[model samples]
Target: MSITPDKAQRIAALAKLAISPDQAIRLAAQMDDILGYMDTLNSLDTSGVEPMYTPVEHVSVLRPDVMRQDISRADLLRNAPETNGESFVVPRII
Candidate 1:
């Protein structure tokens, strides 16, 4: 998982970041360490462990959907700038 300065430079280019040669050298070393640590973590066994999406428990706070007709279709159509006695007429984009 060793990171070379050239690889670091390429990584920086991909991220749209500009770095000097000295910065690239430093970045290579830092990235090497990070990758080494990730390799160590990957060596662990978690066969029986359950996968979790988040560390904390979460609950839905959304309101339930209900069907109700408050406004009539003719009333809604009357407010439109342009319509063929149906939906609002919008400018063609495609």
Candidate 2:
């Protein structure tokens, strides 16, 4: 794809980047070159190739979830300044 200086200026504006006119012209050429390479890559056939998220072989190791004893309610409410018989008692937010 060809990238004009005007297109580069608009792209810079959209990206919130500051660039000079000369820099925009230079960058537009570079951007055009990169896009041309991408276009070349896009023309390659990969019909039988599998899509990969990562280059490396990954194994997600996870710990087994086991049922365990939970802390008693009385123990949990011990440190609270204001707690009812069941739960915490805070000032009404509404």
Please state every model's RMSD to the true fold in angstroms: 10.4, 11.7
Q: What is the lDDT of residue 34 in candidate 1?
A: 87
Residue lDDT tens for model 1, 2-58: 799999999999999999999999999999998888887678898999998787676
Candidate 1: which stretches are off by over 4 Å? 48-50, 63-94
TM-score for every candidate vs. truth? Answer: 0.51, 0.49
Give the Cα error of residue 11 in candidate 1, in Å. 1.8
Error of 1 at 31 (Å): 1.5
When summed lDDT is taken over every stretch of 10 residues in candidate 1, the lowest stretch is 55-64
In terms of TM-score, how similar is model 1 to the real structure?
0.51
* Model 2: residue 58 alpha-carbon error in angstroms: 2.2
25-88 in candidate 2: lDDT tens per residue?
9999999999988887678898999998787676777688987769888998999999986899
How far residue 80's Cα lies from its native spot in candidate 1, in Å, is: 35
